[model samples]
Target: MHPSFTQRVTALEGLRARTRQATAEFYQKPGVMPPPLAPLIIVRSSGNNTFSLINRATGEVIAERFGHNNATSHARELEADIKRFNVKQFGRHLRDWALRISAILFLFAFFGSHA
Candidate 1:
């Protein structure tokens, strides 16, 4: 029989992929205003209590929004920034976020030993 852990990992990946796809589709839909894509790295600074985004490819820092820790506000800011960023750059940033999130999930699944 297939290992139970293997099944769990697969399920996790599927969930992540679906979520990522939905987010992307939302930005790409017609008549939907897209955000700027200057920040390659979107960080929720625990200490600063602000949302920060960094564009590593261009070494540029776009606008930082406060009180955008929630999903709706974060998405709005991202959509705004996405318009300012190059299409190619936006693609790269999206891929980077996806990879980073996937790695985080992998670590939690593989290393978090249960009692």
Candidate 2:
């Protein structure tokens, strides 16, 4: 293999590592995109009057089409299960996204960068 190709592969691998690290940090660190809230914690959504109940791990919507009391109450009722789902779903999505991105990068490096 050519030296330039080898160098390009190394650089792409480094980029892949950094991207994976960033995604992991975004999911693990508190108060990033989705503020880490305890299960069923009452919170208000920005740009709207309706309250929001979210799975802190995935930033997914638990309930929003209901009133504050009902939404929060329902969220509390399902908190445990939702947390489990959120954790699993977060891992699944993270893995999928990372793998897809890595594969795309690999193809681009191996084929598109050929000279």
Best by lDDT: 2
**lDDT of each residue in 1-115, candidate 2, tens digit only:** 9999999999999999999898888878777675576555444564345777776667776567346666667677776665576777989999999999999999989998785
lDDT per residue (tens digit) for residues 84-110 in model 1 = 779898899999999999999988988
TM-score per candidate, chains pooled: 0.31, 0.30
Clashing pairs counted in every model: 14, 0
Off by over 4 Å in 1: 40-55, 58-115
Pull out the clashing pairs in model 2.
none
Regions of model 2 farther than 4 Å from truth: 1-37, 40-42, 46-49, 82-115
Candidate 2's TM-score: 0.30
State the C-alpha lDDT per candidate: 0.70, 0.74
RMSD of 2: 19.3
